[model samples]
Target: MKQQTKTSKNPWVWIPTLYFAEGIPYVIVMTVSVIMYKRFGLSNTDIALYTSWLYLPWVIKPFWSPFVDILKTKRWWIVLMQLFIGAGLAGIALTLPTPFYFKASLAFFWLLAFSSATHDIAADGFYMLALDDSQQSFFVGIRSTFYRLAMITGQGLLIILAGALEIMTGSDPMYVNVTTSPTEQVDYNFENIPEDLSNIDELTFVVYPKNVTINTNKISTDSLSSLKEFAREHNTKNGFIALSETEKLKKNRLDGGETWWSHNISTPLANAIVKNFGVKKEVITKTTDDKVGNAKLVAVRLNKQPEEDKEIVLNTGFAKGDKSISIGSGERLVFNSMNWNVPAYILVQLDPKLEGVTSASFKGISGNIPLAWSITFFIMAGFFILIFVYHRFVLPRPASDHGSAANSPSDILHEFGITFVSFFKKRGIFIAILFMLLYRLGEALLVKLSSPFLLDIKEFGGLGLTTGEVGFVYGTVGVISLTVGGILGGIAVNKKGLKYWLWPMVLAITLPNLAYLYLSTYMPESMILINTAVALEQFGYGFGFTAYMMYMIYFSEGKHKTAHYAICTGFMALGMMLPGMVAGWIQELIGYQHFFILVILCAIPTFLVIPFLKVDPDFGKKDK
Candidate 1:
């Protein structure tokens, strides 16, 4: 008779809880780190460098995994790690400041990474201890499905939530315009201004100055009069005039060869003239030829210095004042008061070089309907496609049926023991670890150095993307491309053996890094180019990463396969961390362009790993 065996009362009970614990902390640390850095106003290089340090706990987790196995039960480790992660997240939320939320958030993320790494070790070990070979075989699919769902929840849902919060609160966009000089000049051209203002009824004028002062009648007039009289004796026409309507005499008078007085007086001495004079007019004429027949004539009073041979023409639009005067050809009007009437539009023409001056319209996202809708539709369609592929193709296949051999309690234990011992003995295990360590070196370097290089206004190292724009490109477009690349890579690997596709994977990965080189070199002002470059690089990374995972699986063969794979992942984390720690310092030393070149140079070691990898002959073969 067959031996009676005790089984889990409910196999699926722990699925959601375990996966949720696994996913949240990992996503918060690994994926959201980029967003946090961007929010904190760090350059790409700085963010990459700093956050990459967070990978340290993950990289060294393998060294600790064995101890977990030897020491207390897996359940204890899992529960404890989960609690730790929750605490870390809560701590981060508490520490986050209104101003520096991103940096504080990242601090908590690092804590989460540490906790999550420990959780991963215990959870994986617990799976082995809890399930027999047959149950393990059947349930592995369930576990992976939940794990993927967790990734989607963490990366997709959480990231989207963060983005929505960023947009609503204006947190990301706040850092865009950096503090610089008090006045940052941007050129504007008045090309659309009507050239011919020949015909019109009432011309309204408004004048504004770069700097303005309001001289209220606050000071005593006697003191001002005495100072002005003294200045006039010194040939300086500066003084205050005080006269009531009854005290002032209105008549045609000339003092400086220009029109000095007018007969028609609206208010006595209200508009008085002193010495300097100028005139500008917007004339309306009745022309039978065209419906909009009108012109604006701008007149000027040429002020010539008597002692010097220089002539300075002070135009009607020169000193800020407004007047509506009707003038025929060669008609002249004079004012006795010092107040000169200038047209409003002449303010922009004061300096010949100041040609560009125009107000900009604020049309929101909805204004660009087609482009916005196109992007929205594309993103939605991509997500749907992913859902379909994941559910229809990837979900149905069980690990045991697809090259995983251990299928019963005895088989799992035997395999585990053999693999566990082989992990210490085999040269391949060490090599695999080394390969994982080297795999992400280039990516790490790129992240660590790209921002400082691009933002170096002094030197040519970066594209100088705005904070919001960079977030859009990297967080949104980059994420999409990464998803697509991962999906494609998975499909490719599943269809063709990793050995046959090694060179293509290498090329795909390395070539995309070159996009960064190009982008860093020609830091384009256009948002489209920036988004495209980010997408391409991320897509390549996604594709290459799929190959890396497959290689780990291939290397983790024989006994204790899951443990070996976990060990490899630790090295992978290390590869990211080591480069990140030194990225900022290196960027400061070598600069951005050269640093990116160095990133490219690091790829050589990654490609070198490809030659040593042995592809499984029956890589994609199904078990009968």
Candidate 2:
């Protein structure tokens, strides 16, 4: 009997895992990181800006894809890049808890991103090398299904897991409360105080001269004293006291009470403390003396802790008669109060901008990520380890002229040049590239901001969904709808041909975006409504995107078809990157409702450009 070739090994064992591996890091780097940054309290602008840059490798992967075929065997590149990806993921986990995590994690993310892109090239090339054309066509659907399952794993399950971890590991911030003793007659003063209060331990009160003007433009102390008196008399009657700075003005109230001024007084007080004392400052006040007999200064101090410590101390001054605040160990008080109202407490995040005062908590919106992150990373690393092992042992190598490409770099460079030149030489190539970019413009913008919109407050025109809910809607329900739509689209195209189905596919993609418009407009909290809308939109996107993809394949039918298709995808990435980078900024500018409307308007180009493109009448028909 003839010896069995390694290439004869079952494609089933490797194809699923190969595509699954290909997808996880891409989703993590692209979509998951966006959600992570949002939770980390990064502004939408920054989240869009930094995370959008991660698409760079994919956008330029075609340039390097030719080299993967030239340099080493596809199997070698796939396994090696997978190893690098695993290491990069572990690196992200290691750096997540550090003070410089944003920088460090992003660096690792960049590494993982590049490696994942290379793996795409290698794994895809390897698939072609190992399988005959018939097998290639046969396993395509299996590979795609597995790839999408990876999407649900990363986008849905991992997100839900992270959200659950957040709830499980999350703790309420420890606030420092200042309570007044009925017997003690505490005097009020605001004068020169040391900037660095981190050294002071226990309750140490620093009294300043009462009614002495803050004497600087930074803080109008005269106005603040008047506001304090006004708040004591008005209580909850004044609307300004109940609103945040942004809300107060929008309510159309003519009275600019002390409540309005005092709500924003913390920033100036912080500035004054920083300027005069050369240290960071926190301003916690009792604007309303409601239940508290009289306003008194109760000074609480912060003890010195290790530099790496992440304990948060809030200087929260509440009015008298409120419940006592509780805190965890390692947490110290700087001051305390009960029944605290808006403008009543001004807690400034002081930056001691000095060498001795490194104790300021950098606790952002998400505060600190739970220790559970390490576990999540380890699990990911384990998955990669298993993948690496399976591929090394079970995968068969393909015979090729690998040594020729490996030895001669110049030949690879020459082929890349020819590949680029020949791609543009195709008929209607300009229009083909135009359609590639425009077809998905609206979808590109939508994908970038969709998660942010879901997590945003309903008042801001978003769905106000939790991270886990978003994962559920997008990952499970939405992805399934997408897959079903894609399958149906393929079947339909096979029966009627792409030309006959083109318009319907276009409608499928563009019209479903209105689901977002409806959600943004209505701001429904119901999961059923949200899921249905998301599923509908995703199904449309999947169906429409099939046409876009098929058109690329159809357009890239001549010589150098592979390289030309790669170039087309490069434009596709570019289309997503350019809009995604700006979508958040645009959403921030226009709010979610208008942003969704804008997305709908963006689809106009897709409709307008259909006439300019060429499609084979029987391209996708079975008889063809």
Candidate 3:
């Protein structure tokens, strides 16, 4: 009784920190890790498939939710889970410098995923136990606010931090500039390649064919494809070789279930879908005798070797330049101990209708990637440790924060059986479960690949935004929009109820996906446009997501509300996990444009399931 009194504090005192801690690990596992792997040169296929599997712990968290209840107090679970999450983060930092960093870091991420899943169970359960029904309803918006803030921190601030750290720990950025003149007969291709490079403190870029000439006078419109193909054939970019077409189709042991399923089932199905509904890309304009783009070979090499024992990665792409004269290939390439001296050829292609002198530039930023990522994770680990310490003291301990009346192991199991049965036995539970499962299916798919699409070079049908830029777009502006939508959603639902706002929120979430379609088709460089799109989309998602959560809480209102809500979340995670696991594979098979189209098409299921959902007229209404 004394302990409970001492621990009791205002809900405002702890909800922010509690939910903030709850959100950090989930975002780190699900979102930030995708960007980290992309920076480290992991393929989209691997990043999506592997990271999507991290959702498994949450999918099956309900299986262990009862165990969480039967074993210890919610406070004990929350504190312990935080410590485990911190340990997992530290483990990732430790493993990043190792040779098997990929596998080792994945192991640690698994630890984070599981610990975070368990933490969600505890923290969410504790929220209900510590507050009365009215208090729970009132502070719901506050908790969600903090969680989204965590998303901003992880998705935006954390990524910006890593990107900044990348520059600090690595050499100064190297620029590969080009000037094109159609009238000039200048060619600066390397006559002889250097066999060895001397070590230097600074790295500078040298692009041969310093003056490019593209005579685009009266060529066939079809020449552009041929021009691009010529660049591809001439590119002998050394250091890394991509998988052959057949190799990408074949299954590997590392991929496990996702690979097998993708190969035998999803591939054929996807091919069929693409052949039918897929948008056909045009190789040439209708004009028969229009001037066509021409491709030029630009051999690139560093002025000096990178620092010894550190593998410096040079990520180069359009950093504000003439849109016509763009990199046809080799936007991002790595340089290391073995290949520092060997020159890699980049295909610089000119846009059709070029007849005069014009110049453009691409910038490459080099960084000690392993070290940068390690330091980033190290900082995250330290943050969790600090939060763990803070919550250990500040979290309120209510008198009702114990397990069910069952005091022994046998009694706990009996209670678990009863709780599980009651949850499934709830009125219209099948519809509730379906609503939970299908509500966020589209988001599950989109969320997984959004980062990859942002980081991928423009040449490969992506936005090619810098890591820091992606962070700000999604984290700051997007999160702010989402938070506003969510807050408004809670208040609106309080006034009008879920039934009144369901269809509007549905449109809110699904309609903004068109922003990606527009982005992929146009590939705009304006940050304002990009942020606006993201903000609208995130706002809709955050708003729509409030309805989903309220429905879960509404459905789980019962004798076993805590355990029942866990089951609902389990389904919620399942909705995200299954689709996210295959998002990358699909994107690779098709491209970002079609992949997004498919994501939009997926919204049909959400709409279909929603009409069938049963809701109370006064479920979320605030009492006077």
Candidate 4:
């Protein structure tokens, strides 16, 4: 007894392992299962329906609680159940990919649920048995805290790891050795032109002498003709004109015919004519030394020639007649007719050394040599550390007070046999079952129907909320309200006893459910109001659920208390399961507003159950 006292004194020793065992499977089934199904592209309704079934083991847990009580020490049940849970996790990790993996995974999860539920029973019973009432009171907070931590570890850490792994190993494209080069180059010359043309049109021509060698293959006559026509229309009689080869030799002749000498032609010429006449002016045309390099051209009116005019010239590798020059809206230039009306073409040559330039490519982590090694090393280290810690420290610690809990093999079989038989014989079990089934009928119905109804959009009776916003309202506000309601309900029950608090619990639970009716029918546009109402309903549920849990405890007071409690939980599970199973189909039939009305109507049964719950007059009274 003294040894038992010492072992129980350090309840912390058992909690981490026990809660860790409870938390991992719960997280896998409840949170990770949903996420995994989503990742695999399962629909919301399917995920909801399938995942909701995972809650079954928890609901039915109370039925098997007695075997742990009567046959073996709670400590034995704890270690064995932990082993079962670990195996179930291993099974899920391995079998999740099979063709029938969903069903198989469900099977494993059901096993895990049973293991987890049994663990909960043992852990809770052991907690009560190991400690005196005072110790139990003092350490309740510790147990709850550890359980929450376990939840965080299971839900948070494992998901992060899985996500990271998926990112690292996932498929991504790869690039190979490739190269690039500049294709061609053309140079031009500039000389023997009037400087006055600079102000007239700002035409910067780089011309080559007519005798310069050229690449006929590189020049297109069709392109050059288009430019010549444009230039002729813009050029005036005072501006330079393309002279015929015969006219080039006829020196000093530049009135209406082409001449070899550069001329500042600003007036209209006989052949030149404007087509789409709007504004007439010479424009500045800046040419790049290399045609391939970036160039600039600006438009300005041509007036007259300047005295100090610099000689205009053009040079290009293309033949005199095989070039293309573009004219601005109001600009033009002239040259000897022997010289083609085409301007010199410039091309910037690419260096041979720099020809191999290639684009930068990103090959994801898998193809990245450095990252692959890093990830491999990191995973290895993490794997070893986890294994060492789990086996060395966590696995050896007995869940119950008995040191031989893990080693004693037959203990589980015996406990299972007893739990199996007593489940059928418990007393007040029927009433407890009925109460559990009826208590939260309205809540289950509302939860099952609300999202589908709300998703329909206002025209169809839904609030038309976006997925993210809905998740936020339901997850954050709803969770907070649930906590608040539970706390308040616990406080109210402690103050007034079960009988007095029963009516309020019923009201709290039932009335908040009406908020859904308001939300569905009115289809409120204000997010704040909708969210507030959601929080309010959640608060009511939290408060009211406290009464429900307490009543279960009250009803489980006789010979097979654990077994009776399990039976009650099974009915509770049934209550939720029945409503949730067909909720989607029902929503399809009735729509949001009508479905919510059905939920409100279901509350009537919960309200009717209030009279049957007895309150202990001395419940809140204390002994000195």
lDDT of 2 by residue, 547-576 (tens): 988898898888788888888888889888
Q: Rank the candidates by lDDT, best first.
A: 3, 2, 4, 1
Relative to the true structure, candidate 3 reaches a TM of 0.89
TM-score for all predictions? 0.54, 0.71, 0.89, 0.53
Tell me model 2's lDDT, rounded to 2 decimals.
Answer: 0.67
lDDT of each: 0.50, 0.67, 0.79, 0.51
Task: Please report how far candidate 3 places residue 315 from its true position, in Å.
Answer: 2.3
What's the lDDT for residue 93 in model 1? Answer: 52
Task: Give the number of the best model, judged by lDDT.
Answer: 3
255 Cα displacement, candidate 4 (Å): 93
Clashing pairs in 3: 188-209
Residue pairs in clash, model 2: 177-335, 177-336, 178-335, 178-336, 189-208, 280-352, 283-346, 300-334, 318-337, 318-338
Name the regions of candidate 2 deviating beyond 4 angstroms.
1-4, 172-374, 401-403, 406-408
- Total backbone clashes of model 4? 53
| lDDT at residue 319 of model 3 (Cα atoms) | 63
- Give the clash count for each candidate: 29, 10, 1, 53
Q: What is the C-alpha lDDT profile of model 4 across 383-442, one tens digit per residue? A: 433533453343322343443345455876676567646755655555656678888887
How does model 1 fare in lDDT?
Answer: 0.50
Tens-digit lDDT string for candidate 1 (1-624) = 212123323456665456655765676576555554443334454566667778888877766665566556566566566656656655565545324455665677777788888888777766665555777789876786566565565545554554444334321110001111213433323343344343433221111222222111122334333433343222212111122121233322323222334345422223432111111122222224322211122222212111122111111211112111111121111211242232112111111111222221110110111122223223433443343243232222122211223255576566556755777686665567667878777887776554344333322244543334444565567767877897788778777767666778777777788877777667565668867877898899889888788888777776667678877777777777877876654554344555667788888887777677666755742320
